[model samples]
Target chain A: MRTILILIKKEFLQVFRNPLLMSILIVAPMVQFMIFPFCADYEIKVLDIAFIDHDGSRITQDIIHSFDASDIFVSHGIIQNKKDAEKMIQHDKIDILVEFPNQFEEDLMNGEATRIAITANAINTTKAGIGVGYTQEIIGGYMQKFQEDNMFIASEEQIPARLNLSYIYWYNEQMNYKNLIVPGILVILVTLIGCYVTALNLVREKEIGTIEQVNVTPIRRWQFLIGKMIPFWILGMVEFIMGLFIMKLVFGITVQGSIPMLLGITAIYLLVMLGLGFFISSVSENQLQAMFIVLFLFIIFVLLSGLFTPTEGMPQWAHYTNYLNPMSFYMEVIKKVVLKGSAFVSVQTETIVLSVMAVIVNTGAILSYQEKSK
Target chain B: MAALTIQKVNKVYNKTVHALQDITFEIQEGELFGLVGPDGAGKSTLFNILTTLLLPDSGDIQILGMDLINDYKQVRQEIGYLPGTFSLYPDLSVKENLDFFAVMYKSDIEANMDLIRPIWRQIEPFSKRKAGKLSGGMKQKLALCCALIHRPKILFLDEPTTGVDPVSRKEFWEILQTIRTQGITVLVSTPYMDEATLCDRIALIQNGKILGIDTPEAIIEHFKGTLYTFKSANIFSLLEALKRCPLQCNYYPYGEHCHIAFYEDMETAMPQFLQFLEDNQQEHGDIEPIRPSIEDCFIEIVKMNRHE
Candidate 1:
């Protein structure tokens, strides 16, 4: 135990002494955290829209005016014909096109249904999908108001009966993309800091031949590994807490669950990640090899971690593979606790799995480490 | 008592390169032992096995009468190893590296200060400096301090002076002598044959095999032929000329002279050798019999084994 403490002290001294590494540990994550959430946003904030208005009536003008007034669509004014609108779309000047029939206003006046064709570019599928949804909501709102004002004049038989739909978003009421993205970014920040640092530290010793000196000592393999792991674990926690502050201050995401519970699970997840780092470092002979291996696994962990997209929507094989990914479990637990104000009972299963992974990977790290090679 | 005993140790890397073959030797307590060989003669491999950092494919090694393989945990507490390379953390300060290794052994510098005092005193002035920034000699001294911090029963130094300046190399060997005087058995490996003479006893090794093992004087005494050294204005031309001469001898360029060991009777062979050199028009100086150093014996032994 004394030996382990000394080793930990030595590791911390080395980490603090290297200014480049210190800055990378502290600064890179903060910069990435500040930049990534806004860049990775899935919300379609702008849809460049153009219209072919065959009917130059006030009703068509009002519908076009509504699209212009909204925050999401960038209205390109009215075009004379479909050919010119198609030409604009081909030129990449417009992402969406709205076409109205010559009888569109006349049909609505006679209490008959008419169609407004919405042609959305499918190149960027998500933007196109969400833009279509926004368009329908705007047109629907305009029609509802139109019906209420004109309902008293229309005969009861001509008026069509409709089933009204309403929605209430439960957890994220405003559907703020930042709230989801910020927590996911926090998970990545904590993971990269923990795993990348730990992985590089040991491999560096091997590269410089320092590990051979340490290996000859009386220190137990696990003791040395734990000592190597502890300082980085603390660093990872520090980065995580910093990310939490940024989440609240910049993104306005306050954790609704118990703070201690969040930290408790974060500690376990760090163990799993650090163990993975140790495992990689032990198997690798040099820093470059370890780096590539860590990068490959990190890519898989982050992409499949359900941070950017919902795991529920993934294919059957991908969902099954996420079970092997520690980041996925941590991502789920963090989102639940932060977004839903979930208590310990709700996150119990994920916590248990993370704890089990912590044991397995750490044991694998200790076992794979050869203090005496064959 | 035997501080370390190895009976028939063998190591084959990748089933092809025989790194150490049938290696067997022993060191008594407080004795300074040397494993002398050239760069690729498997000295580092032997050191790794002795330090519990590697496992020999087949061998029985006992250190202080305890099994080196099975009792490695206890064995580690009793041995200090300075590998061929400078293995201390370069980013760490001299003092920090010392304290870190001391703590690793669960020992304290203050408690074992006397053991490392001789080497530590020289590096203490540079204690604040990072090890990587230190000169080669100072880096070695700091490494020595770290290795001796635990005060192990035996110490392993593999080529400690390989890259050090000549003055520092002498100082390093002197330090080894001082260390030996403190009753710590030392096993040092070096490629310089002159350094081999400094050890109490050395095992001459080559091509993963032990060429000879005994006191330096005894190995010299065992030299088999009449060795002669003679200067030549053109040593390379003399060597080419000698290759054509009909004589039973082993010859090699030694510094500015050619050293040849002849197995035939010298009285008859000497006159004939001079005539042969004259006939070949080889320019040479007076040839005189001289004593063989450890290097001569090593070359002779390697050559003899090759002939067999």
Candidate 2:
């Protein structure tokens, strides 16, 4: 343990001595904190849409204008036909097309129910899915408003029936996409910087030929690896702090629960990052290879870990895969703690799952390091 | 106990290329032993095995009376190794590199002041400099200081002076000698033949085989021939003339002279060689007998062993 402390001091000395690396460690994360949360949003702020209003009635125009006034949906006047609407969608000039049949209001007056078609470009599934949902919400809201203004409920003989849904987005009441993305991306930035720096640190030593000198020393492998891990772990924690401050200041994400509880889980999650980084460092022949391997793993971890989407809603196989992803647990822990104001007991499962992942990955890493050191 | 012992060590790479074959040698305590050989001659391999950095395909090694494999952890605590390349952290200051190794061995730099001062004093002024920024000689000095910071029982230095300047190389050997007086066993390897004289005993190795193991002077004394240095302005024609001349001698071109080895003393063969040179019109060339150098001895042994 004493030797580890000494080695840690040596590692820090080197870390401070390198200006470019130090700046990147501190500065790049600050940049990510500044830029990533705003851009990694899932919310579709604008939906360009064109409409074919065959009814030529006041109700159809009113509904179309209501869809346009939702602040998220915009109207591109009209498309004469389905071919023109498809062309507009393919040209990226519009996103959705709402077509109503002719005599739509007359049929409604005659007590015959009618339907309208909404065609959307489904190339980007998230955008298309959200756009369709927004369309349904606006039309539903318009129907309710029309009923209230006209002061008439649809009886059994009425042409149009009314259904109502009030979407109460729990946790994020205002549906601020930044709130959803910032916390999850905060976990990712910390994990990313932590893994890459730690992996490259040891591999750089190998490239510069200092690892052979280090290998011949009396220092134990665990002590050496742990010593190497501490500095980056501290750096990762610092990056997390910056990300948290940025989260609160820029995104207005108030920390609802124990900050220390979130950081405590972050600390455990960093163990997996550090361990995996050390494992990669030991296996890689140089820093370049180590960087690429860490990057590949980071992308895979973030993508499959439900940072962008809920693991609960994913396919069963993908949901099972999230159990193996440390980031998934961390994302849950952060979101539950910060957004839901959940007590520590509420996130107990995620914490335990994260702890288990930390143990497995770190042990695997240390043992792999021991094997390579031989 | 002897400082180190290796018995019939064999190392083969890729199951085909023989790196070290049937190598056996030992060094006494406090002995400054040298393994003299060229590159790819298995000096580094033997050192790696002894220092516990690499395991041999087949061998038994004992360092300081402990088994290298079974007692590796304990043995590593008593050994210091400076590999062929300078392995100091380039981003670390010279003092940090020194302090790291000292602390690694559970001591401080001040604890081994006497042992490392001879090497450290030269690098003390640049102690704050990054190790990579220092010149080649300074880098070697810093490496030596780091290796000695722990004050191990045996120090393994593999080709420590190969790329260093002559003056610094000489100073390095002087420091090694100084450290040896304090009762530390030293095992150094180098390709330069001149450095062989500094070792108390040396194993001349080539192609993973030990050509000869002896003190430099004894190896030179055992050269069973009278070696002659033949120099002339026109070395090519002179070599051709001497090659055609019928004299019972073996010859090869040395730096500025053609070295010829006679089985008999020069006095016994001089008259016949003089008549042959007279017949070949090469009588004007300077012919003088000289003592056998380590280079001359190494080549002679290599030739003898290859033929046998």
The number of the candidate with the highest TM-score is: 1
TM-score of 2: 0.89
Taken in order, the candidates have interface RMSDs of 0.8, 2.1
Best by DockQ: 1
Measured against the true chain A, the candidates' chain A TM-scores are 0.94, 0.87
Docking class of 1: high
Backbone Cα, N, C clashes tallied per candidate: 0, 0
DockQ for each numbered candidate: 0.81, 0.57
lDDT of 2 by residue, A127-188 (tens): 88889888888887777666566555455454356655568899999888878888887888
Clashing pairs in 2: none
* Candidate number with greatest lDDT: 1
Docking level for model 2? medium
* Error at B136, model 1, angstroms: 0.9
**RMSD of each candidate?**
2.3, 3.6
lDDT of 1 at A85: 91
Chain B of candidate 1 vs. true chain B, TM: 0.99
